[model samples]
Target: MKSDHSIPGTEEAPELSYRILSDTSSSAPVIVFFTSAVVWLLVGTVFGLIASFKFNFPDWLGNIPALTFGRVRPAHLNSVIYGWASLGIAGLYVWLTARLCQTEVHWRRLLYISAILWNAGVLYGVVSILGGHSQGIEWLEFPKGAQTLIAMASVLLSLSILRTFYGRRVKHIYVSLWYILASVIWFPILYVIANLPFYSGVTQAAVNWWYAHNILTVWVTPAGLAAAYYFIPKVIGRPIHSYYLSLLGFWSFALFYNWNGIHHLIGGPLPTWLISVSIVASVLMFIPVITVAINHHLTMVGHFGKLRYSPTLRFVVFGAMCYTAVSFQGSIQALRSFNEITHFTHYTVGHAHLGLYAFFTMSIFGAIYYIMPRLTKWEWPYPVLIKFHFWLVALGITLYVISMTVGGFIQGLYMNDPSRPFMDSVQVTKPYLMARSIAGVVILIGHLFFIYLFYLMIKRKGVKRLTPPWYEKAEEYAR
Candidate 1:
């Protein structure tokens, strides 16, 4: 009897051959973006560790203005958000758009230029922040010059994506493409509006939070969700359980998420009606969250076992679950009653990490694991290193969130009490802050392992493999 599995480039596998061609078309730009993302991830991790330790040892770097927590914290944030997440998602946008559209990437030169400009912007922004030239807005800390470079890069990148999407050969667009296309349209507009110079005082606060929250909604969340929607089903060899649910999720997310940021201003100088509307929108987010959870869970119904074998499945699924978890937590946090306790406390810090690190970063990690082998035509050097990388970060984030949450809640209680001294709240959080520093160390080590592995794979220094790196035989996986 002949084997049933068709090799990817063989005559019997026209669809697979087309996919190989798409990957080939996307390889160069994707490699550059992914490489830059990893470098930024390492840089951001170091900055984050320093910031975390400052909570426990504020005087350690107090003499060095550049290493002060105020500077280092935003440096860490900009490096991770603009450098790591943006670059990683840009790489994914190129590859996923080509694969889904069944066409070669258009405007390849623009993409290369975009990558260069984006990296330059992030580097400039990080250095400027360290040198105390920040814009001083929470999320928009980058100075105008840095923002300009990033904005220009974003426009070029968006043009390339739109061109590729316009030339698509496929008639029916995938769910992933919906998010990618929407993000491409939404982000540049959001970025341009947020960086406009006129706003000041309370208006600037409103604009700052609006941009901070929408950036995650329009850019990071969509990228993470798109990766989950594609990789989960792709690795498990199944279509999404319900196209209707996916449409519902996407439309509802678009409808509700834009209004969510104002809820952060529940007790601020903003108009009462505005804050109330934001709360309603935040609660309404449950509609999309539940729909997406169902869609992913149904798709994975019989495929849970695959998580043990496929690293892509493992990281993506973990991220998907975290998406549900973090979204629910956020909805709860948006409530005025709940926000009163968690706002300005370490609890918010934990929640931010859950969404950004556990959900978005992990999803991107899974994407890199799946896409790199295809792009480089080389397997990951060591499976053990990958496992260590996953567990160390997982454990680190888990510990970090738990410690901060418990300690923060207690701190919030002390803060609300009139009799207690403010120092009591600060003193109570000391141990948790120490734990956070330890967690940062663990995460930094994990990142080091990941970057080392990435370097080896890029250099093609690993043991040669004729098969994919699934936990089982490639033949079985193919079948």
Candidate 2:
């Protein structure tokens, strides 16, 4: 595919010139964020595998405090969420904001500082969690000092991004920018409020869920969605199927997602109206989900064949489809009846992976696959390895989610039946837990391949590409 970076109908010389300038300006900070994110991805994967295996071999590491399931599981979560996902998103924000804005990134030095502080915060928080210094809140388990560092890093990063956005030369902002802009603005406020020391008791629980859910909505989800919006059409060489639909999707998502988190508190001691409103918002999520699905799907209806050659398109389209599936599943999950069955079960675990790993992580993977080459000006060294990485993670997540959902449903059924002993629930989930462990192993192998490929690309060990890798013959479709 031709590397056309101009807006449709606005493919002027200045736009093309600015695209090159933007890439050059954003390259260093982008690479730093991605490199840090990959390191964390490896760390998180190891932690996750340990956590998964402990279910089947509970005593294997039972003697080690840091290796125990409690510490390992949360460590896995924080590593991936704060470290891998957040860092990757930061890199994408730097690149995408510059590209969309038609300007070089601003305050480049601050972005480098932000990267350092972010990594330091994650490192300190992970150590503190393993050392039993956890704050005990779900997502905010990071100690106060660690949270402060992350919050400060986020502010610095936001300053750079907002400054770039302000300096944009474009007459019209793109859809991706809207999400990027919203996320940077929303996250620091959410992070700071959630980390405040005063919340306790039931109020703490409420704030915990609020922050847990909103972090995904306002931070990660927007970045993931922005990637899908940008990469899908960019790779396919077409504009999005519907710009108005994209706006509708964005606004509705912003309106409904914040409220949907309270649905996690359905069975808790929260106020009836609070839970009721959350349920309503969750159900209303269908509006945005459907609109996004239509926009992405219709955009790719005829370009499915491109997935054969473009690793970026394959991962992104997979992620976009999963975004639809997971969002719909989330809407169903918020209902009182479904939540009753799946609330505390491994089904929720399956659901979270479907959204986070399958949707968001894969989207980031696709973005990196596309963005890294442009920044580094190197082709992927091993096409076969890319294929292997894709199938491994794809099949791995499929098995993982299937086993957890099916097993957790049975486990839930057993628990709900008072006639059956609680042990029955535990016993029934063993096989599925084993399946999840196997899946983790597969995904870990994929990450290893990806990390190697990334290293090769960064070191410029690969053959230089004369053109972008389009599946089959390169065909330039109209923007």
Candidate 3:
């Protein structure tokens, strides 16, 4: 890691920070986390691009077994979740906890072991999926061995984290820390419960959907949001806009999100009581989502201009807004009438992307942009590329969301019309699928650009000169 500082009457110095965490020592575990995340981001992006493309150009990739839409969709999803999202967040967690707790990572010996086991589980899960070993479960489609391995590794990771938190430097715990703590606490319970066997098909489906949505609400969303709560306010140089709103967001979500998972099955064979309860819970979630949204928006009220200048702020606010949109849409879509129309359509796919990609992934991108400079002790090598990544993904998602929403409506109308053939209804979705595929390409390009830029940031031989991170409208170092 390196640092650059300018004095009023002196030349800038490009001195490297000797520590990885504190610029003291190389932390291979951290590097592994980052490397795995980057590689998988590209991998997942490519598969997703192919899957989206297949909707219109069904034979674009030929009939290759591994490239089929059915296969590619789940494969891409697994890579994105296990390979990119989980690894990055876990890596960040290890560092963040160590820093906050003011202690070296507790299980130094398990560093390589946990990394290997975690990655091995992902590898197995992905390959088994391609081999048609999926359990046909929504999110838990991975092979049994991979699932258990992940559980085992998670246990070890959680232990280390618990021990780390037990030895904290600060007396007052921050909101972000609480989120992280709750996430780890909630995850293992959900993971095991989701993996358990059920007596009936209906019960299994209910449990699977529960595990799937909860992972987002409890695991990925929390990690991403924790980053938001800490980084957004810190970057803006202010405290949270509403402390009450913050607490409201946390408690409301905790109470509602886990229960709302059944909403995904509202039209299915699940008990009427279950679906009814889920719909109410989902709608009630608007309380928490709005609370978080208002907190972020009000905090950035006067700082919207900063989005034009700070890549970190710009992309983060983009994500925060998307979070608002997703939450609102989610609460509404849980209504029975709406679910009847939107279920089993590209519309549902688009909604998930809105929450997972536009909201969570964008926030993580912002976190990386800001945190990497400090963690690696190096500024981004190509700032312009960062801007390209931002706009490409932003525009891509916009098109994706709009097109799918429209197509979903068309799909629902056709489905409701008993006179129409199912294939005819599916045909109506082709244009939307094609649009989403194009969006995927645009996003993929953005990913490749960032991967390259990220590489340069770490390359010791990368351009020796240091420059300020890029922004839409900022002078040399203004952003």
Candidate 4:
């Protein structure tokens, strides 16, 4: 391909220029999000691999408290959740809100501050955990200083998105904006209440769990689901299945997801009413989950053929289905008998991967697939590498999730027997532990390949020269 302008090798295309203009103003934030996410993924996976190995050989590495499983596991989780997913979502929120509201980010410096504060908070928290300092709660393990920084960062991010909605040029304020805007409001409340120092013991525990769960549904999920609501319809050239149903999905989730976190402690020391309320909320989440599933399925129903041809569509569809699967699994696992068999095992770890990786990360992956080429004014340097990136990680995470799920079930079931010794159950899960470590390596390689792909795009010298760059499909080109 030769550029239309007098420039070195690049595609010649007009539409690519507009895509650049629409996207590049926000490119710095996007790049910051992705660069930080990749680094976090690497950091988290190293910790995750160590955590998995610790399962099989508890003292293989060291007996030091700083390197112990307790510390490393939280480091792993916070890096993945707060560092990767939350940063990615913040970036997506900025991009989506700008598109919907037809407004450039107001006070773009705030976005830079938000991104910097967020990265600093995550880095501080991960380092502190490895230094054997943590709050020792599930999700709020970050030290108080780090937690406060993160909470403030969330305020900046929330305002960045909400201001757009307050001044949207788009008449109808699409369902995606509604979902994301509501999520911004939901997050500050969730974080502030969770960080309150007054609560302790089981009350503290309940609040912690509530914040943890909502972090997924209210923060990471809405960003992901909103992206789905936007991209799926746009990619397929159709409206969402029903506007009213979209509203229903957003409201149902807003109402129900807030209280669903305590079901994790179904039989714990917490009040029966709190756990019971959480259970009811968890179950009611099905209304929103199923409704969104129906809307996506119906919107995508006649467009199935496109999935075979479009890489972005394929990944997004897989994520959409995984959303359905993970949601149903969460609801089922919330039951007392089910949690009795699955809680606190590798089963929970598996479920987390299914939702976080298979569902949420897949959507992020799809969004990148669609967004990157547009920004760079070039297609993927190598299609084979692109396809390889998807399948390898997809297969790797599937093995990771399934092996852990089965191993966890065996561990949980054996542990409940009381007669079976704890060490014996650990012996049975050794193979699964090894499998998970190996899968971590697989995903690590997949991420490295993606980084290379991105690097190639960024290094090309004649980006603007490619006025009308290659388009994967007519619909994408038309945009």
Candidate 5:
């Protein structure tokens, strides 16, 4: 990666002590992890579109058992969450670990084996759910056998990361490493505890939401934030505004987020005190959200112009903004008053997408744009495709989220009104549901384009441009 201290009169140069992109042993697993993730992304997109279409055209699949909305929806969710985001996060973990530790991966073969086992577990889980073997939990729908495989894979990966960290060449660990390492620790514990089959009835429901919510907060959100922390500074050619602030954000998140997941049970049959505690925890999460927002946005204070020249900057900043928006919105949604309107409505669906797609998934996309080129030693085949992928998915998700939000609001209001027939809400929401279908199509197109571009880069078929697109000095180009 190139550095630019374009800001004049900077007495000390930004730190370039980190090593990156030269560790083929580490890069190999990243490639496999990411490539498998893209395949799952495409599969998840198709399943998501089918689910959207079923909202409007229920007979489109003629009542096939596997194609039913109930089954396909969970299949889509599991596929994207486990198959796509999990794999992408694994890839990010590998790269971040190697770079920060300043060492080649110690157990490269184990990472390779873990990647394969991880994908296999996710595949089996998705298939089992569609095959009616689901464990009937929301996020832990995967059967115990598949869950065991995933747990084992996580254990192996986590051990590899810890070993790398122990051998780190740098004395002072960056804040991003804190997040990356924390996620590795948090996920396996959450996974094993949540997937244990001992609980039933109300307890099971509580455990289910606990796993689902924390999977997002502890696992997915941390990976995305880690990437934003690294890439934002790397692309902007600056250190974070405050390392102390970043540490504060990480500790606050670790402390509050574990208690926050229970808020998803706001109106359910859970104890009032538990619910109140969760509400407070959710609200406390804002402290960290604000800290992160300030750290990232403040670091980019004068480098907003770099977005024009850096694809990674654009994707990451967009994701960082979404993280702030989604976290704030989530805190509000956890409130009893706000949950009264949004709970059990499509509004919740839209909110989930806001977190998963706009925040976490987009962050991974940005990291890929930055990491893949270095790993493959080839630039993206077409800068235009990069632009296309960005705009298409951006527009698609915006439309998708907005339509569901407006439709859900209308649905909730109608549901609350005594005089309105229940079907009235459905009638009014029909248009928005259709709009979601359209948006899904647009997003699918973007996925296809991204997959093609990824294939080209992996094949190393692009022109030999060492720098990112639009990254050239006028003098050098003229020569």
Candidate 6:
């Protein structure tokens, strides 16, 4: 039963490598962050479903102020972005940084405190938004009180990361570490500038887009890409296609994405030159996107078989593919002609989910699948459940994106047609809106199953077996 593959000691290497890569010092903090992130994932899913339904069934929860569309929509956005995505990214980077550096975390206490405060701050922010205390900024809807606490939490977490890097055992920092560090450092600066109350009128609008778009490009994109860079090679037991290409991708992305946000203000009161520059930056994003995509795909070449045996590879590869699709789509969407039609449509919502859920969330899910077993010393209990979770979400998001994208395109066309009545466009969206709601329910089902699976993993109550859950061939060789 020895491996037919060329890599010598393929069976033993994973176990040995995992032992070396796992961070015992930061396990507690990582667990806390992941647990909280899952809790928020559930919360945000429910809120998203409620918001979707309000589109077609306006009276479903109309009686309650907090459940109203205005409130619920923001609640959904904030919960997922801050509560789920942020925490998940934090947990991932901490584990990944420690693993890559070949050292344990330095300021463990700081990470612990930050986890507590970060959750509290997010909870307070969601509550305040529901209570009608929104800051009235798109992504900055959290009240000042909540923003302040979250900002403080971010500072603590950033410092903890720096401290970890300070005591690193690796002689050379890996590419993943670079992305993680940039995200941590960029976040607080972005947060502080975006939340400052001094700007007004058009200036404020510009600042809002700057913050929102940069959060996606600078903060979340790096985290997801870093995980992709690490896990693709790790799972396949191959080096990245080109280390030099990866560096070019990272720095180019950092330089270009900062100016990309102003594209969101196209046709607004902003100066024409500013909007044009943003469009140029958005197009320039293709350089990095293509470079990284090539690097990942080349590394994954000839390892397509691994997807069947490695749940981690499946999810990570799906996310990596989506990253390419979404980024290219984003560049096209940023063009003036394209933006004019889709800017105010549900198309943008689909686009956001493409980036957030398909790319970032899925990558993180794959990461958790790989790391959780390493942490708990038990493999996933049921491959069926993992398969179920994967398909349910994959199908749900597919349906969600198709419906919204087509519906938004129709609505946009209708809006531009002066001959058509405005309400007609609104009516055209009803069916798609319902599809979105149904898609939410489908995704929620998958999420619930995921949480239950995580519970089983934590309690060590899964099926009894000696082999890695996904890679049974390994056990054959080991025996």
Q: lDDT tens string, model 2, 343-449?
A: 88999999999999999999999999999977877789989999999999999999999999999999988989999999999999999999999999999999999
Give the candidate order by descending lDDT. Answer: 2, 1, 6, 5, 4, 3
- For 277-385, candidate 4 gives per-residue lDDT tens digits of 8888888889999999999999998789987666678778888899999999999999887999998788998999999999998888888777666555566677677
Per-residue alpha-carbon lDDT of candidate 6 for residues 350-465, written as tens digits (9 for 90 to 100): 99998999999999999999877765567799889999999999999989988998999899999999999999999999999999989999999999989999889878887543
On lDDT, the leading prediction is 2
- Candidate 5 C-alpha error for residue 352, in Å: 0.3
What is the model-wide C-alpha lDDT for candidate 1? 0.90
Writing each residue's lDDT as its tens digit, candidate 5 over 194-305 gives 8776999888877888778999877899999999999999998899999999989999999998888788888899889988998999999899999999999899999999
Q: Which ten residues in a row have the lowest lDDT in candidate 4?
A: 1-10
What would you estimate as the lDDT of candidate 4? 0.80
Off by over 4 Å in 3: 1-27, 461-479
lDDT of each residue in 388-448, candidate 3, tens digit only = 9999989988888888888888898898889988888988888787888788888888898
Separate clash counts for every candidate = 0, 0, 5, 5, 0, 0
Winner on lDDT (1 vs 4): 1
Cα distance off (Å), candidate 1, residue 69: 0.7
Error (Å) of candidate 6 at residue 209 is: 0.3
TM-score of model 1 (CA atoms): 0.95
**What is the lDDT of every predicted structure here?**
0.90, 0.91, 0.77, 0.80, 0.85, 0.87
- The regions of model 6 sitting more than 4 angstroms off are 1-22, 463-479
User: How does candidate 5 fare on TM-score?
Assistant: 0.93
